[model samples]
Target: MRNPAFGHRADRTLPRYFYVLRNRDGEARLPVYWEPRPASRDPLVREVYRVRVAGRTLEAGNLHVLGDRLRDALGSLLATGQPPRFWLVNGACASPVYREGEAYVALTDGPRLWGKDLAELVGRYAHYLASCNGGRRAPVSVALFSPADLDVHWPELVWTGPGVWIPVFGVDGRLTAFGPRDRTWSVPAGPGAVLELWERVGNDLVACGLLQHPAALWGSEVSDSTRGALLASSEPTGLTLRFVHFHPSGAGRVTLPIRRLEGRVFASCGELSCLHVAPDPGTLREYLSAHLAQAGVVAGLQDVVLEEDGGASLHRLVRAERLPVGLASSHA
Candidate 1:
């Protein structure tokens, strides 16, 4: 009944470098670690406490910030008397992870949980992770999801990590994808708006039912109007845009390439080559401009447009600076 991970200890002895706070059931509710700053001149601060729940480093001189953060992270853990499903820690550096129903989703932006729908929430998390860590090989922070559906759909993509193949499986028996993941991409962020377009024409196929599943119109029951509307939806939308940094140094930039269109949340990722749906053309261009500028790749960017209807064809090319100056003028 008790989670052995927390251990059964009546006497709560503070460890050398880490502090463990247990709940009423004696389960480890919040375990925090820190390093002693002996040589520091400040008398008020003797050690830098590590809060490892958000997958980022937070060196606190005091416990106020640490307590506030831990309180939220430990809220559901205390009630359920279960340890975090997934924890990525490097010594005292750790981040908060929350268990949401069947999905053990991790939030990198902050402690608050956003999105009511499960798929949309996952979509947002995927969007955030890809934008931030798309260009880099080693990810500073990682979020997890239920690999049940992912494995059934994409099995070969699992366990493609670095050289050291230490098996780290998710809640399910096996994980869908885990590794230093990278998207197979042809378009590079250059000086111009590289609009890569794909038109769904000729025996146009429209996906129906749940957004997660990839079911076609052949068997799935759907109205003629719904199928027609989806087919007629103009332009290839950008679901996710990943801006790989030119120089792989310094702190990485976390981009959020998530948009809500027609009452649905659309997320984009360059790594996952195929998807059931995408955003409109206008929105995709808008996202690209912001994506390049934020990643600081606009100076040398060549705006390229590719239409993938009758095969991937180069539509046009324009220098990013030469484009009409409007919302993106400042960045150019």
Candidate 2:
């Protein structure tokens, strides 16, 4: 059966706003938010979408207008400071939200979708509507940045006009993180999210082949026993990367190592964190087996020693596995 939310058969029209666009499956879904023509508008000539909120109903031509009304109704409380965070045609949100550096921007679209293994926040429609209009929803999503996480990682919230932007990388030399934004983090970020940034730094360094050289490990010359010993040590030999997937909530993040790797670069992934998270951290024979098993990636381990002091650590990565593709982020 056709979903009526798309619209009535005679005058089928769909809502294009963010919230209405995503269905229960968290896939692309269109709902009949409002129609082009009026069935019985309090107005005789213009068409309007009748929106219901907190037992109150409103009529407007589109979500933009509807959002404006919501802003006025819930003044002084928009995470977005200037105006409502409501948007149309993927345009910039009208509000001037928080400050990241010198820029002030609104929330725009968030808690955005992430990998398929991630699930949507579970909550009532009322809370969703309230939060969308004004950041009033609680317990909806896992904290992106917990207080403990924040102490370890500093956030770089940048404003790019309509919405706020998050920076994913910092300059050390030549490596650039594959992407700048966390697609999943478009929503209200938790303090824990800062960890994601650290992990990305590691992932990118490995991707660029900067930290791929084994020589970076045991010295100018690579030693067989050294390689075997380093790989064999299980006691936090080095920081490792991990992509944790929650069961139902459509939220996911890149977690970082706590000890010394907090805000460091991936060239230092081994020196800071352990290499346990690296895929091919095994010895010669074991590595060859892993490399052959996963032809998609060149599985290998490399140690990087970069600190004011002469400290080093082990690192490894499954190459070519971009976050979105490797994580299967393209579905419900």
Candidate 3:
């Protein structure tokens, strides 16, 4: 269960580079490739020494080499530093640049044995490669998950990086981090609030979940009462809500216009929504009148509002456009 010790090599026979060294009786070295770097400058290298203590390999010494000629320089540094027990050198750094092929291999082999989650393990390795190569951005592959098994497995797979946690949602519409807490966070799932359009409910705040179509709704089942209350508060006037579907290539289109009581306009598409409230009657009237003028000509006035909740109730619109007839659709 112990993590492998990773570092760079210090020996002059190997090119100056980063490596992952192992410890047997002494320091064992494994040279790490310096991904891709600027062609004009030599790749910077680091020497890592590891020792096997108990059952885990522990890092012993790490040294950095600036230039090929700096072999003597690095040697001097290591002489004063801790000596490694064993080492191995890699002539060509394993391409830190991960691709579909590499990701498949890592997912099948690397992560299963390393005790590291695939995404985090790949991300960290990618980062290390990028850093050694002077901040070159590495391509990332999307992690795959099955919808049926998401609920059970997602919690165990949560991975935190520099700032945010990846795959924020667990299955069953619950926040992964709020273990045993049913009512994780409360927000008004009513008017003035942006409800994810794809799902009738409000959830869809997390990045990965937002990417899903028919975005998941937020709020617990109890919020059904709250939704009823907001509807009741709105004016009795009925407005038309139009749902427009567009093609990616801007060719095919379909429009659905429905009537609903209006207070403030709210529209949702996938995991995103927009709410628009006019500041004053004048502003509201001006917007509607303009739309009324262009009513049928060019997909005008997608939604119509009849009553205002004492606040400016402008039109709210959602764009659930589709791909063009010939264009390929995105894999959700």
Q: Which candidate leads the pack in TM-score?
A: 1
Write model 1 residue lDDT over 70-162, tens digit each, in one string: 667546434445444334322343333455664444545454434333323334554555555664333232334221211111121111111
Q: What is the TM-score of each candidate against the true structure?
A: 0.26, 0.21, 0.21
The reply for model 1, stretches above 4 Å from the true place, is 1-31, 62-65, 72-142, 145-332
Give one digit per residue, the lDDT tens place, for model 2 in 1-332. 13434534544344433233222234322232556565656564356655443223556776667767654543543334322211111122222123243222233345332221111111232244466768664322211211111101111321111112123221221111122232322222333233343244434434655344221221111123322343333233243333322223342332222122223222112221222222233322233223222332222222111112222333332212223435544221
lDDT of 2 at 175: 16
Collision count for each candidate, in order: 26, 27, 26
Task: For candidate 1, give the lDDT of residue 79.
Answer: 48
lDDT, candidates in the order shown: 0.32, 0.30, 0.30
lDDT, candidate 3, 249-302, per-residue tens: 543222212213343332211122112223233344344333333433124333
Cα error, residue 316 of model 2, in Å, equals 27
Clashes of 2: 27
lDDT of 1 at 170: 25
TM-score between model 1 and native = 0.26
**Candidate number that wins on TM-score, 1 or 2:** 1
